[model samples]
Target: MKKAFVAFILLIFISTSRAAKVTDWLDSYNVLWTSQSKGSYDSMPCGGGDIGLNVWVENNELLFYISRSGSLDENNCLLKSGRIRVKLTPNPFINSGFSQQLNLRKGFVDVNAGNTNIRLWVNVFSPVIHVDINSKEKLSAEVYYENWRYKDRPVRKGEGNANSYKWAIPKGLVTKADVIENSTDKVIFYHKNDAQTVFDVTVAQQGMDSVKSKMYNPIGNLTSGGMLFGDNLKFAGTSSGEYAGTDYKSWCMKSVKPSSSHHVLIALHTQQTESLNQWKQGLADIVKGIKSNDDKKRTQAWWNSFWNKSAIRINEKNKDSEAWKIGRNYQLFRYMLGCNAYGSYPTKFNGGLFTFDPARVDSTLNFTPDFRKWGGGTMTAQNQRLVYFPMLKSGDFDMMTSQFDFYLRILKNAELRSKVYWNHEGGCFTEQIENFGLPNPSEYGWKRPANFDKGLEYNAWLEYQWDTVLEFCNMILETKEYNNEKIDKYVPLIESVLTFFDEHYRMLATQRGRKVLDGDGHLVLYPGSACETYKMAYNSTSTISALTVVLEKMIEYSAADSTKSARWKQMLSTIPPITIREENGKKMIAPAKLWERINNIESPQLYPVFPWRVYGVGKKDLDVAVNTYFSDSDALKFRSHIGWKQDNIFAACLGLTKEAQRLTSLKMKDSELRFPTFWGPGYDWTPDHNWGGSGMIGLQEMLMQTNGEQILLFPAWPAEWNVHFKMHAPKNTTVEAELKDGKVTSLQVYPAERMKDVVIMIKK
Candidate 1:
């Protein structure tokens, strides 16, 4: 009762916080995404870094602010405000116990742990930040004023308190960003990593040096006394030791507002010890580029076009309702993910979306500067796929293509590293390969709690490198056309992956006591089952299921008469059947061990339901399979979203639309801890950093569904919707669903090709 009451209070708080009208909330700024926001084919860092934004209209005066957070300010006007000032200041990291003030009057907050603070101070004046690395070395700073917008703007209409500007931040800089948005005066500061750095910002007022200093906890938690971090400490201001007297650069840019032609000034300064002239040239060129660009118009146009691609009919008849709220919110949420997809950092592995929070990190990370609470890294297959689910369904094919290019490139590196780690073997992929496939210093050949290399011969050995290609291959395969060169490249890579597994397989007659050489190996294990545990006493259901699918897929692609393809077909024949077991009156799918111990994560048995197709209501063993799923028991139900989790997926297929609706309502717990976003507390409740995207899938499943082969229209939406939904399928097919009177009135499909068993449900 106490838990439920607290949860209820939290829910009320969240609802109240999120209840502002869209117009009143989002009327301030507009966001757009494009090549700039998307980054380039061979862009620096090969990913899109996020941008920062500040724009407001107060007392008939426009208070506009932006930073080069993400190419948002391609124009460096802000970098060249009136009478630009330059100075050489000591860097912060070298010193200890010295507190530096880049911005002040916003007050200070401190973390209870290590006195670190995650500060959020906006005193109705400005969102300012101070970056004080260490108080020892002097650095240079530059301020840009009245700058043009970047080609990519991130604000959008109907957004409430969402960011309007995105500042592009390049990789490999040593500094901190701080803000104090409210006070008699607002302050923004850039604290440097070393003896030299640059401060690039835009401000309106100039020639005024009324600055305030503040000393807050480094971590800046809102509550608690300051505790200096062990290895990551924030230094002090009165303890400054050295200040440079070397080189400096300055520039000023002033521009008239586009709408009112109100005058605005931009200033920029740079300080460097070595080769300052090059810094000047680079700064100057970038500023010149910023000055010459037409950012506002470009960003607006790009965003306009993006939203026009599809429209949401929340109430279809009425765009406002509880259903509409969830639907439109979901619509906009998809757009946000689209903008951030691999935009920067190839998407986090643990927590893919809703603010990069990793599940766990290594202890040595303390010696590193990044906060432990900032979350963990180390990408895995389960999380990666979840992030992209909405992408594939939402007509963001461009993102899908970019993702493919990104992952394929990464896979090349992973393959090379796997060769080295697994003795140059063709099979066996490691647990966490680096972005470029080289292992990070901390994780390569790391020890595990489960006493096995996460790179062990698990299903991922075939799934990660190969299964990732299946959807793309399926799309291309459906075409039945010829892109011989592309085919040759992808096919060979795919073939090589298959060859590794085929050779790695150990032909044992008994697998977990099954008749044939079943689930005992990594990719083709006889005893080992889904996710390497929850095994059946006899057979490995997930292994054989995956192999059956993978092998069958490879054979299908190998041309009708290909020799190797013939062997793949033969291999499938030898695959064993899954063993069935009953436990306490419930049918379950465990062919090996009931609950064998392993260091695996996520529910792999559901593979037969999702990603890989082997079981579901449509399959032969539907009852037994579902029984396996339901019977698994909820020992850890919260993490799994157990009953309610699978309910959403199964409801649509079983035509139990009402149950699906109820489950979605239960799943979404709006609160500060939970971003009005769909991720949840994993029984442990810390937030399932990896499951944010899965909620979006349930949303689409509720609206439209596709069973590996065909598409479904309004397969699971509530009768109250009374609406129309238009969505794009794998091969560029446009599906439209028009619902009225609580049933589908008409289902239209403009399929690019022949459609599969597309299920279009109507009022019965």
Candidate 2:
């Protein structure tokens, strides 16, 4: 008892020595709004689980856009659940002395105006949103459901860029009018997909009609419904409006609670149901589960643990400085990712679950709220990885399952296509594909003149780019290193992904008069790509690096079975070596062998520096990696701290401390939105998650890095900056460090024995 008690005391001492409360810093940066803004762009975002709300005060009325993840309609378009507007008997927001804030610690928004104050929160464990209003005196309130899609709206070819498949989809794919209804005192609305959905159209176009029955379809008979209920509220019929070229309708409810406080609950549910009655029942059940006080406690408990997981803070002493903004924005961006923690689909890279009106983002687009840059039907793997890769270092492992399972669910369909197309046995995932592992219907270029490669993409940027899944396979392996829970389930996935490269490349080699076993027995990767750049190349660095790293991990995990282990070991040796070339008398990593054209700005050669980590600070090939970053012409031209940016990552990997700090600060700086995390339209859309993801990864690597069993503290951190951070590393270890004024004031490592592996980079 004495020994155990002493150990516990020592643990607390070690933790407190280095780490302060994460919430202490978070509290200081909470978003506060004192005045009303012009449009939805000025709104503050709040959400929990899979539901997100854009809350703002405009035209003396409180309004919010309700969006739930994976709410697809008949067109395979992700749609907004709807909008809600609230009005007080006497509007306080119109007067001087009104304030709104997003409380980061509690994961909710608070608005105070005149005599009334409203607290809005989405339940973290249940699909329900709450609006609790309290006033100094008794007040009457009117809540209304505002829906712009009250009638079928034709999806045009050129709407806001977020409509990923709109142009490719057939014209006249109209969004059916939302079916609005009132049951007793409740006002509800839902959008149900038609019997023939975009999924059916895509399969028929792709010549997969024979096997369409076996494909996993998420659109048929799909419905998304929302219900609003409160004891004080009574249904007050409906109203219509035509404003700003938009025709819309609203269901009104008037309420006057006896007391000063009014509580209203809104429950949202999306399902593949047989009928509207089933959806109504599902919503009723959700409300019943969350209407009690106990559920609020459960939701708060989940959020409390979420905020406690891991955090990073940069202290610049000047709150308004760019450095402070970087740190605050990092946390803010992470908050958006957390909003979809329990989503059925992985958060979309274009906007995740928080996209607002399209007209607000781009005035010329003038599309509905559902419009975003990329379509809902397609998940572009290249941009998609940027959204989830940073979760590894942030220790948000639980949140990663949604993405991993996304690919797993589509694995069989991908494999079937490979077998049907090339008589091959491995799954073939393309750069842009539907959720079911088929290439996007419109992007597949089925109308090409003649003799085109049926398996290759007509778009130069996406052709021969099937290896991005390797990054996710590495993510799974890394997750196991941090926690041993999911290994058994992911092992097969890792094996199959690696096997595809081996089997498919061998088949391609035979047609080029190159034997699979010829000249070093390496697999010939002709017609390959170094990212979207270096098209029509052979033996690309990115593909080889992914093959080498993923196979090594697969062999290690599958060692118990000799056959599986040997197959992976052989495949690793058969992957072509990463190319090196001399440019301006400096040796650098080459994009690929026999490179021809450059289509995009991505630096595929430096990929070895990242995702694979074959060359980095402590690794033997550090000089080569550093030279690649400095001398690569294309890399230098494309480098920016914007959406899907990689310069910060390369700098950190090369131990270029000052460069890492400068680039990371730029990448993490305020995204120029009223809400700082809504980053970009840079190569994607507003609130570009890939941009946020790249920044998150860069900041994480600057603070903590792992090479095998050795942990490097502040490996790429600059000397002038003071930082406090706690981040997870491989092998069930966490390193917490505090550096103030160039001194290593405090440091702590979990599982003290791992301290032997610690390499402190900070100078005394």
Question: Model 2, range 66-173, lDDT digits (tens) per residue?
Answer: 989878887767889888888887666666488899988888899898888988999988888999989887778889888888898877667623443545645566
Error of 1 at 66 (Å): 9.5
Q: Roughly what TM-score does model 2 have, to 2 decimal places?
A: 0.96
Q: List the global CA lDDT of all models.
A: 0.35, 0.80
TM-score of 1: 0.57
lDDT of 1 by residue, 262-364 (tens): 1121212232223444544543443344321243234334434444334335563453356655555454444444333324233442322222111222222
Going through the candidates in the order shown, the clash numbers are 94, 6
Please report the candidate that would top lDDT against the real structure: 2
Most TM-score-accurate candidate = 2
